[model samples]
Target: MSADQWIAFAAAIVGGALRVGTPFLFVSLGECLTEKSGRINLGLEGVLVLSAMAAFGGAYWSGSAWVGVLAGALAGALLAALHGVLCSLPRVNDVATGIALMLLGTGLAFYLGKPLIQPQAPQLPSIALADWSSNAAVRAALQVNVLVPIGLMLALALWWGFARTRAGLLVRLAGDSADATRALGYSVAGIRIAATTAGGAIAGLGGASLTLFYPGSWNEGISSGQGLIAVALVIFARWSPLRCMGAALLFGGAGAVGPALQSIGIAWGYHLFNTVPYVLTLLILVLTCRPGKVAVGSPGELSSTRS
Candidate 1:
């Protein structure tokens, strides 16, 4: 490849990062929020798939993309709320419940999304960020998803809220020491439910991005395990919203590598390239998880991290 081709490849990866990373950003932030309230909702995979189907169906029926977004968020919230409620029961295991929810969510989506596979729906609009570039490839690569900025702003807001607000403190307190929160007369169950629901809503938006924006369509395989990978992403980010954003972009770029290479006529090992993100996820888990040592900045009440 010449210099120009290399440049295009780099641009494609950057664009893919922005395009692909949006979902990761939303889902990881949602998980971070849920963990902050002393609950971990691993069912986000289900939340993500179910919401994507709901979003696509809503857009196809309503002829409006934003309506689809709303439908997705609502679906995610409702599903996540169920997980919260189930986990709140005596002697229920959060991890097992989450796995069950993931299965249920995916099954529901596949069943309900049958009619949606063939229809075209309104798609989310993009903001042209490379209008100045005469190169069409550059222009196409720089077309930013409208949801990217919104995700960025949400990350910033979450960071601020966690660091400097009463609500944030309460959430942290709940995650760190439920007994402490209860001693202060707060309802730990209630807080966890609310946080999980809110997190699901945000994750629903990530689903919306998948169907209504890049690779914009509804399919049983649309999610491709991104929701599951987000669990590791949160751990990699140390549960910080801002760091989640960066980690998401990095994963997004990793995801883009195969496509970007193919775009530049490098098709060999494409399948291997697509595995980068998953490999990265495994590496992060290995590096972060140690024998009997809690991860730094991990929520105290998060069960998976506790020794």
Candidate 2:
């Protein structure tokens, strides 16, 4: 490819990373928070879809994109709360309940979102970061979603919360040792429930980003399994919130490979390139999941990491 083409390709990947990574960043952080509280909520896939539907529907009706974002968060919180409640019941498996909720959330979204498919809702605004550049491609590539900075700040805040705050310490304590939390007069279940709900709300914002930002539309396939991929992402990041942001960008860049190639007149392998993120997810799981071995920095009470 020529120099200009190469530049365009690189620009495309950068743009794609920012756009695609936003949702990954949110969902992975949410999962990280839940895991830190000694619970796992795999139903985030459902949360993403349902929240996307809700965000779109809310924006369409209320004519305000911010309202749609709130709607999305509420939907996610409600679904995640149900997961927390069910998992708290005696003998209920967290993994099983999460999978079931995933199905329920997706089914509900599809049913309720039927009318949303054809409508155009208010979309979130963007920040044009490349206004100084005269190149159209560069300008297009640099147009960032407003939520990108918010997601970044959230990552930093979470890291600080986990490392320096009392609430953070309590959540970590609950995950590492429920008995210890109980000894300290804290309700382990309550801490976990709150963490899971908060995580779901964060993931819901990711869903809102999907429909209200890049692609800027409501569709059943908008998530493309990003929510499910967040599990591997968190594991890959070694449960670090800051590391989760980097991992999300990496996955997002991988996801952008297909489109980047296509933009440079390389269409033959576009579809194959699009599978890069999934392939990366498999590789992360394979490398991280070894029999009888828990990943380093994993919470002790997390069932998946428990031996």
Candidate 3:
């Protein structure tokens, strides 16, 4: 890349981070919440796909983008709740339930969203500060949706909620030691169910962002496992919500690689760019997410091992 080309590449990466990170922000925040309560939902990918379809269908049916977003959130919450209920059953594996939900979510989205594929839905409004400016590059620099900031704020709020509030203490206590929680007269299953529901609603809204606002379309192939990668992001952020936002934007920027490269006419390398987030996810998981370190941040009841 030439000097100007490098500048453009850097610019593209910034824009890509803004546009692409929305989904990551939501999903990561959702996963962070679930993890805080000592539960994990692998079904987030499914929730993403389902939310995309629902958002599209809703916008098409309701004639309002905001309504579609709410519909999508509901879909995601319902799925997440189902997973929560299933996991609440004796001997049910959360990981397995998540995988099943993923398949179920994807399948339902494809089937029900068939009608939405053809409609030309109005693009939802975005907060474009630079777009109003006379300068083009400056405008281009800030094409990201307003939700990006909201996602960041949510992380900060969650971090505070987890570390400094009564509800946060309950969640932490439940996640850290279910036996102790039960002894204290709290229902572990109930808290996990609530956590899963909240996580699902938020993650679903993230999926809605993909179809209703950013690219602003309803399509089956919209999500690219931003949801799954979010699960890994939780580990990378070590369960800190603020760190999850930072990690999400990083992944979002990585996700912009293919398009960012192509924007400057470097099409040949575009294929390699698409793998950036997953590769980063793997690297972060390995380098930053030491299993031993996770214990401090993790809920007492959650365990990939030692359960």
lDDT accuracy of residue 214 in candidate 3: 72
Ranking by lDDT: 1, 2, 3
Query: TM-score for every candidate vs. truth?
Result: 0.98, 0.98, 0.92
Tens digit of lDDT per residue, candidate 1, span 1-307? Answer: 8987888899899999999999999999999999999888889999999999999999999999999999999999999999999888888888899999999999999999999999999999999988887778878898988989999999999999999999899889989998899999999989898899999999999999999997999998999999999999999999999999999999999999998998889999999999999999999999998888889998889744431
Q: Give the C-alpha lDDT of model 2.
A: 0.93
Q: Candidate 1: where is the Cα deviation over 4 Å?
A: 303-307
In order of listing, the candidates' clash counts read 0, 0, 5
Residue clash pairs of candidate 1: none
What TM-score quantifies how close candidate 3 is to the native fold? Answer: 0.92
Q: Mark the regions of model 2 whose C-alpha exceeds 4 Å error after superposition.
A: 303-307
Taking every candidate in turn, the Cα RMSD to the unseen true structure, in Å, is 1.4, 1.3, 2.2
Model 1: per-residue Cα lDDT at residue 203: 97
RMSD of 2: 1.3
Whole-model lDDT, candidate 3? Answer: 0.83
